[model samples]
Target: MRHVVKEKSLEDEEEESLNRQRLTSARREALSLYRDILRATRFFMWPDSRGVLWRDVLRENARREFEEARFEKDPEAVTRLLIGGRDAVESALEKLAEKQRHQIQKERGDGR
Candidate 1:
């Protein structure tokens, strides 16, 4: 019984350690995604007044989404959220790039 209890305690410690590592990794990924989204928002085209509004909206939405998932304990759920956020950031970046490209082409009279 003593030996069995010791083995179970060791196993529990290992599981706790793994959970901590996973949480740390998830936190880092979440922060990275938050930064990337804010960076991408800067590239969005808009007048000064509307630009501020857009930035605020984007930031608030991102903050709310992360906050809503702040208590997530499942590693799989965190992974899925990270993947989805990454895809969203990539899509936004691509859209920004395409918009800028078109703007430049139009200015050069090549978009006519």
Candidate 2:
């Protein structure tokens, strides 16, 4: 038996598709930022597993900014989201440097 979808359900599905498309478009601007965030998080996961605080903060800020842009319907907020996401990713990268420092110190101690 072939199942038929209700008209209302089809309409809802279309609306959901549109919403997803819009979200994808907005996120395209921040894709690089997201990748950077991931790289930073991975970098910070070494040695003593430190820098969790800043990494979490950057992640939260990036999430908040993206949500604001996705739902605010304001052009300015959308722009801010793109910029803020990039900045947050950079902040995460800076934290990664601290992780690198900790790793270096640990290696030096072991050598000594």
Candidate 3:
């Protein structure tokens, strides 16, 4: 019985260590995504209908979303959220680039 208890304690310790490592990794990824989103916002110089800078709106929204997930422990949900956020950022930038390109073409008399 004593030996079994010792073995169980060791297993528990290992599991705890793994959970800590996972949490640390998730935190790192989240911070990286947050910073990347902020950096990407530099391109959005336009103002919204509310007269607020898009950059400010984006930063605030990102901060709020991160805060909402601050205590989430499910690894799957975290991964999904990260991926979705990244995709949204990339898509927005691509759309912006397309509009800029179209505008440039129109100015050059090459757009329809």
TM per candidate = 0.82, 0.45, 0.88
Best by TM-score: 3
Model 2, position 67, has a per-residue lDDT of: 57
* Model 1 per-residue lDDT tens digits across residues 2-112: 555445588899998998998998999999998998887876546455556666677789999999999998899999999999999898888878888999999999995
The candidates, ranked best first by lDDT, are: 3, 1, 2
TM-score-wise, the better of 2 and 3 is 3
lDDT of 3 by residue, 1-112 (tens): 3555345588889999999999899899999989999999999988999999999999999999999999999999999998998898899889989999999999999997
- What do the candidate models score in CA lDDT, each in turn? 0.86, 0.66, 0.92
lDDT of 2 by residue, 31-85 (tens): 7666676566654433334645655655666667555555566556766767876
Residue 3 miss distance in model 2 (angstroms): 39
Clashing pairs in 2: none
Candidate 2, backbone clash total: 0
Measured with C-alpha atoms, the lDDT of residue 14 in candidate 3 is 95
